[model samples]
Target: MMKLDFKNRIALYYLMATSVISILAFVFIYFMVKDTMYDSLDHSLSYEARKHLSEIAVVADTIYFTHKKEWEETEHREVQINPVFLQLMDTEGQIMDKSPNLKEDHLVMNHAFSGDTHYNTQLKDRPIRQTQIDIKQEGTVKGYIVAAIPIESSLMVLSNLSRTLLGLFPLTMVMLFLISRYLAGKSIRPISAIIHTTGRITKNNLGERVPLPTQKDELYDLSTSINGLLNRIEEALEREKQFTSDASHELRTPLSTLRGTLEILVRKERNISEYEENIRKSLVEVDRMSEIVEQLLFLARNGQASDPSLQQTVALAVLVDEVLSRQHKAIKAKQLRISMESNSWGNFEVPYYYGSVILENILGNAIKYSHMDGRVVIELNGDPAGCYCLVTDQGVGIKAEDLDHIYYPFFRSDYLKHKQIKGLGLGLSIARKAALAIGAKITIDSELGNWTAVRVSFDQKVS
Candidate 1:
């Protein structure tokens, strides 16, 4: 089977509809013309019948023409142009006078026809229209008169009209199809433009957008939707590129440090104490690498859809205590002051692993970045709106410009560039991902050399 393109399909359907309408119009026109021609023929035969009946006179018991010579005129005799035939007969159905045009072909008297009825019958092997009119004398039947006329010219006119309509049908349809196809092509030109623009776009070049039409129609909506999709794809690809670059840089530093430590240890025959020291140093770098790997794996898992099976209601204040306990050593080493206000009125339901990762990252960052002898405060509470946990740290705070990008992976602030802070910059990134996966919101408020407060708010249902 041959397939039609969109443009051709539109044209074909329009043509099919047009063909049906044209056929009906042609049939109506043909019948109307046919009826008009036959009506004129009937009128002419009636006029002749009335004229011949007037020329006759009924005297006593006999009936004859009042003017015999008037009935012998050439108009009634000639058969060149449309000729009229006339005839006369008595009630006994005897031979009657007829038009010279009829010659030996006399009009047949139908006794079955009683009234002045007009009908169609054959005359001398040709089609003719006839009618019978009864002549009366004082309500007594005297004789009958019949009149007929040929119908060749009327039939010829009808036949010509039919042939003209038949000849023009296909031609008119072809013209209509062409016009419809042109209009359809103009209407859908924007779609072609969209296909072309989108075909040239790829993962590496997703900046291209489909052009929008001026009319705010369905096609305009389609173009806007496609552009929106392209925008999302481009943003995702950019994030992937940044992640790959940052992961490579972060992994290389640890491997290089471990390789350097091992190279120095095997350079000479060191004593057991020295070997132990070197092994311990190498192990610290290996541990750091393993931690980074774990964080990266957790980040990857957070990108997936959350599983409902892992969800459980947790006492948020108790969870915060656990996270703070895990970072006890760091807090103790810094000699930081800790304060907690646990006013939590509800238990938040969230995925266990996600909740753990989010709270740990935020609490760990609070402890890690705090100054020695600095104060760290944690507050867990719930309101009618939702549940919230806030961690405020008196730390080397982030700059205003860097706050917007703090959740990007491996995006450490420049303020901590030369500091002795130990971090891989994935903490906030993991925290944000975990928070988002469990339908929570994390907001950070920080100022340079002041304080940074991280707030996590859970949905009302979970609260």
Candidate 2:
């Protein structure tokens, strides 16, 4: 067996349904016509039998026609063109009299039949519609009157009707199938166009979008959804390209510094103090490159699927204190002032690794970006609804326009102006991703060169 495509399938289904209805309709029409012809013949035969019986009389114990001229009628005498035959028979089944048209042949009388009834029988080897009536005197059935008419013309009409219906059925179905197939093709033309358009789209042509249909139906919705998906893919690809370019530039700077320092050191011999300073400088570049690689790896790993078992109840205040302690050296170097306020909120259920990463990066950014002797506030506030941790720093804050792009990996606002701040821009990006993994949200509000506040809100809690 072969499989049919959508258009052919649609046509076949339509044809199947129509075929059932057409078959029933044709059968009904043929039967209705056949019944009509039989009914007309029966009525004519009954009338003829009644007329002949009216002219007959029963004398004592015998039956005979009172009017002899009834047998001389043209219809009774002729055997051609709508000929009707009449016969009379005794109770014992002997023929008493018959029409001249019947010649030597006689109509059959069925003894098994009771009352006046119409049926089909043959006379002289020709088909006929017949009816039988009993002649009686004082409730005694002395004889029976049988009347018949030829039915060959009516049979021929019915046969021709059946043939016409049978022949036209197949032809009509063929035409219906063709029309249905054509309509189905036109209906799905939009889908074909969508497939063609999407097939041409590649990474290089991600901006291409599918054309929408004129009607705002299901196909239009499908086209709109595909275009929306393409938009997202194009955006993600662009961000990926930018991230790669930034990562390469950042890593290359440290490598060049290391290479240049080593080349200078190997060029000529240096005294102990000069050698020590150069070695320390080279170590600083090596450490910077190592930090960049480590953060890149952290971002990549955080973006993957996390294990559910790693989730546990974590005290927000404790996590905040630990992050601050880890960044003590940076705070001390900048002489920054740290103040923490907590409302004694209980531990919340979260992925521990992701929670720690979120806190570590948020606090680290506060300490790194704050000016010397500037104040930094850490607030932990919670209710039965949710928990919020806010870290605000009074430092050279980010510009209002660049706030939206801050979450992009390796995105830095005013890098040349903040060159003294030695760090990769992946802190906030990493923190945001970690927060998302634990079903948390991060919001930042900042003014250029004034102050910045970062807030992490957790919607999940330990019951």
Candidate 3:
């Protein structure tokens, strides 16, 4: 099938509807005109028949015109140009007399006609409208009178009318189609503008937006929707670019440290103990790079829908214990005092890995940021609706301005930078992704030089 543009399609549909309506209208008009012409002819024929019937005198079962001079009048005797024909018949269905206009073609008496009945038949190879009625004298049937008039003139008028309408129909439709196309194009001009504006937008030119119409119609809504979609695309592209730059910088730092260590070790012959120390430092750098790669891959996976395989009924107390065990070395090194308060039914339905990642990152950050002997409180609560955890740490807390940005990938606070925390600033970002994938919420509250609190809330009812 061939595809038509919007304007042509609209015009074509309109033309189809108009054409049908026009044809019906023309047919109605033609019939109306034809009926009116027949009426006029029938009226004239009746007048002629009555005029001649009045001149007849019937005496003793015989009928004859009383005035012969009226019959000899030229106007009544003419045969051409809308002439009327009259005939008189006796009781046996016989033509007694006829108009001079009919010549030898006598008006045939139709047996089917009885009284004042008008009908149509052929006369001299031309059409004629006729009416027949009986004559009476002394309460007995005497004779019949028939009246007819040639209808060629009226038929010719009807023929010309039909031809005119048929000939003008195509021309009228053509003109209507052109006007409809023009109006249709005008109505849809906004769509063309939208296409042109969007064609200019690209990855590098995402700031461009389609112009909006002043009238708030469907086209305006469409333009706004397209602009909204473009805005989302632009934000996503910006995030992609930032992620690429951050990943490159983070990867480069480990590679550069490894290269510097190996270069120094090769500069001189060192004792076995010294060489072992340098090799161990290089291994630490390799481990940091591996951790960054693993976190990046986890983020990518969680960006899509959460994995169903990892979803299970997890006990919050058990998960917290596992996370604390992994961070025990840091907690002991900082001499942090840890406390736990949890409900007995502190179980949540969530992806297992998602719950693990959220707990591990939050606990690790609490341990890594706490001061010596500072209290790290872990609380858990649950109900039929959901379970929640709170991890509060007395640490070099974030500034008020940095609290909002903690979930951004590779976003580190000025306090963490100065304190030289052993982290790549990805733990909270990874936790945020995992929490969102599991339909959980994480919130942070912190005061500079006071304390930092992180809350993780999970819904038990969600499958």
Candidate 4:
């Protein structure tokens, strides 16, 4: 079956409910009337059957007439002998007495005894609901009294009832239908209001919220969830707008600088060495601008840059070893003996491309900051609460106050803040963002003169 929509579903529900109730009511009335009417007829038939039997009582093996309530006082030749109908018969199949409706004194083919109490015989002209009963005398089969009454009254009552039902049925159904329609509308008003409110809201017009239905039913719950979803969407939209504005501001100055430097270099042709030096410096600035733009794009995209095929269940222990070994070139070039520790649960089920990038940035930062021939203890493991990759480098570490600002874009440690560091101070920021995308948290602990230990922990439990 095809599904019914809400309006029709409500209509059908009302229709079935009313139909059941109406049928029960009609059937109850019908049965009650029939039973009560039959009881009254039965009582009258009992007396009539008893009286007719008494008149045909047996006396000395011969049937004698007794009761004569229905006998004529005088005979008149002109007046038609009232139809001989009521009769009484003997056990030997002899009729002793009869009303004027009978043809002979005894029954012809079939006989009814006095004791025949209650039974029916049908007639064709109309329904003839008749009853026959027996009349007995002193334990002997005597005679019968068949008391019959035409079912004219029952027919008339039923005919009237049927007519009344025919006339009233359509009107009752119409009334019920109207009642159902009204009820359905009343029940669905909240839904209609919700639709109206929802129509008013668009992507650009998320400020409008649906009003909770006053009834506080299912509609209220629906409204609350929709409103919460809209709130999240609005927040995301605002973040995008802010990013667009900040990106323009951040890119504008670098582009102008690169343009001015290129213009100056192109104006005059210098000798090879001088030209080479100037061009390298100019290229460095250009590279800085390029890196900044790439970082901004990377931040904007977040994890959208990840290739789905690169995702795999990787061994974190092996990853740590690989990163340490890879960073050995940069590690020794920076002149630091970096230690290694491994106790991951054991491997990370993640993408390899993004994982390598995350490790390179983190480890590269440690090597860059480490002192010449200094100790950089790299612990790949932690106790209990999940795995850890801790890199504590012995170098001019972060100032106590600058720790919080270190992860902000273009923010550097006080020592490296003024110096021409290779990065625009976004390596830690990018590493933290990538960590977040893959479900990890980064923590930092440092002192001005001691060491800077950056911990990228694979948290045992997710918040």
Candidate 5:
């Protein structure tokens, strides 16, 4: 029910695995030693039984050791400290003879077992390893010689071994857990650094990045990805700040102009002609503000929603013609000659609203910037690969250095030098955003004071 952190969990898992292995190893060692002790005792018992059997004489159901020196051994005489006991039993289970060490306690013969066999039994409440051997005369059954050795020393050795293993188990587990926890903490140190660094980052310090680890492991990759995301966020924030500043300036210019005009008209009495003229000027400023607001809204809307369902099939040539028509007044004002060139192409599947916005802005720019009586050419070309609409104009072309920033909202090329050109500098920005929304590519190429050309390419979709 309780939760552990990554480090503790790793340590716990390692300890659990080690504990199982250590317990098994301890058990194996204890049993191996116990078996070795028992085997040595059984071997000794067999040798003692064989020695006694050679000295014993069996004469027609009567069995007795011929050598009295066999019972004179120190082991057969003593009851404690590695003592050996010897007992003889007949077919009727009556004891024929026994060593002095087993004076009151007799080794019980097991009838269920015959011949030579080793087993564990008690003598005077003390543990011992024992064996039974038959004494035969002329290949005829006579009696059994039971030999035993006290096993208290071997049992004490095993008991001490067991206690030692049991005591070390928990200590070993604790040591393993501590070592594992330390190593696990070291392994995830990079993650800790990342958390601390990222926590300190805020909007005011957007440029700061997380430090990357030297090793190219998973943690290093994670840090790299986090830095990349921070880069994007910083860039976005910068663009947002620039956009807000520009929008405020562009909107304020028209508002100030309208306010100045209205203030002048109300200050003095004027005839219908003067009044109507001032009202017209104010209305023009109002229209300019409204256009800027509408363009801003269009950009915001297109950016927020790009639903595929808004796309429909539209004829590229027809769309170009419609945009050209909308810019008819500007073209007339500039006295620019318009030309249209079309290759074999079918209708394109694109978001019609955005497509129209892209074309309108591109065409408007061409018309607005072109020199008087200059040529403006519209070319629509397509094949199986894709479709492209190219609009070129003999305009006061953009500078080479300024080309990169043309897509930025309210960014104009040489605005101070070409102050007479009337625009809020959002045409290209809107056009690019709209083009992107409709899955189109727009490219611009121009030479200063010579010509400017804009091209919009669409993916292959013909109907």
Candidate 6:
């Protein structure tokens, strides 16, 4: 299992995400306020510029008018306190009219100007920022008017805004860090519980289950499923323990009987005539034990079918013939007549022992469960899909409801209870494993009246 670092990384990610979002929001608002403030400043400067145009004293002979001294007084009062101050330069390169608070310097070199623009000039011995505009009548530039407004207030507003944002940013970052930590704890609690419970389940501690919640959210559902699996694993381990004990007990009886019988037969003066029969019975006992041991090893090895060396080319006909030959005695005694179905020999590349174990299980099941005069039929066919092997027997078949569980370990049909069958219900389970190891499938079709027919198919074909 992979270990997860649940606290620091989670908190960091949450904090980072929130900080990014908050900073982006702050930036958006800052720009909007900046544009709005600048627009208001520019509008006020332009409006005052238009109003201050009327306060100008036009001192030309053709444009002579009364109230010249009043205009001069008005310009002095208007320019002293008003925000928008104006400076007028003549075409003769001289200072024509300068407001009361305005300077005559820095206005030496300038030409016709219009629209809106910025310039820096020394006014009243201070550098003043100015926006220049031209007064035009009948498509001619009369002169240029430079409107100056102090940018100190705007700079103050922006500086205060920046300070406020900088101050709030750190505070908000701290708040977001705390919030991320809290949320990470809430979200990762279930995982922590799962980890703690999993840690408690060490070797031979299969009985324990993962902690779960009642809400059945995604994590809860996952925990619930794992708990259910642990229960099954616990039951399976318990059953395996019992099976080992049962097998030991079962083998001891046969071995003890054989030992006693052999002791009697080995007496010096006794059982010279019973030597062959005694040897036969002893061999039978040995054979049965050997079979049981082989089955147990098969069960153990089935879990690791990913071994690379097991891959091979298996001829279906050759495998079937081999299994049949091994059961020669049983077949002959039962007078069983069998016929193979394939027109030509076909092979499937699969695990080395796939067809061997599969045929052994099915055929052995047929032989063990068949009636006095029952027949077993086997057929192999190739279609567009790879190939299939079908085993049909006249023996008792499984019921519909019990069919699903028949491949589970030690799972046998109800018919086996009354019939003379001697198996621990591992043949079908092993067969199913072998089929899966070879990337094949086993499907059963049977009824109460007729016998069972198991079809094994390798669905994908090579040449």
Ranking by TM-score: 2, 5, 3, 1, 4, 6
What are the per-residue Cα lDDT tens digits for candidate 3 across 1-463?
5799999999999999999999999999999998888787777777787878777777766676678676577755777755777778899877777667778788877888788778889887878888987788867779988888877777789899999999989999999999999999998999999999999888889999999999999999999999999987886676667667777888999999999999999999999998999999999999999998888766655253445576565677888888888888888898889999877645544556778998899989888888888999998876567778989999888988888898888888994356567788889999988887778889999987778999898876543
Quote each prediction's TM-score. Answer: 0.75, 0.78, 0.76, 0.68, 0.76, 0.64
Residues 38-152 of candidate 5 have per-residue lDDT tens digits of 8888888899999888888887777877888867888878776678899988978899888888888899887777777898888878888888998877787788898888888
- Candidate 4 lDDT, 1-463, residue by residue in tens: 6797787678777877887788777767777887777676666667665655555656765655565545553221111331223555566656655554333332232345224344445433433344556555666556555555556667679778767766776678778877887888888887888789888888788888878877677879998988888887776676577467657876787678767767877899867887787778778777777777777666665344346565554666677677778877877676677667554444543345555667778788777876778887777665567666777888778888888798886678874453844556778878877787667778888887678888877655421
lDDT of 6 by residue, 2-49 (tens): 454667577777777878998899898888887887677677767766
Which candidate number has the best TM-score?
2
Task: Report how far residue 309 has shifted in candidate 5, in Å.
Answer: 5.7
The runs of at least 3 residues in candidate 6 whose Cα sits more than 4 Å from the true structure, single-residue gaps closed, are 1-5, 17-32, 43-82, 89-96, 100-116, 119-128, 132-144, 200-243, 258-284, 303-318, 333-336, 339-352, 365-463
Model 2 lDDT tens row, 1-463: 4799988998899999999999999999999998998888888888899988887777655666677787688887888878889888888887777778889888998777766788888877888888889897778788888889999888899989999999999999999999999998999999899999999999988988999999999999999999998987786676567557666988998889889988998999989888899899999998888888777766655353346665555687777777788899999999999998887563544456777889898888888888889999988887666888888999889989999999987788999998988778889888887776667889999998888999888884421
Q: Please report, in order, the local distance difference test score of every candidate based on alpha carbons.
A: 0.82, 0.84, 0.83, 0.66, 0.84, 0.70
Q: Better model by lDDT, 2 or 6?
A: 2
Per model, how many backbone clashes are there? 0, 0, 1, 17, 0, 0
Can you give the lDDT of residue 199 in candidate 4? 86
Task: Give the TM-score (vs. native) of candidate 2.
Answer: 0.78
Q: How would you order the candidates by lDDT, starting with the best?
A: 5, 2, 3, 1, 6, 4
Candidate 1: clashing pairs of residues: none
What are the per-residue Cα lDDT tens digits for candidate 1 across 57-78? 7776566667868746777657
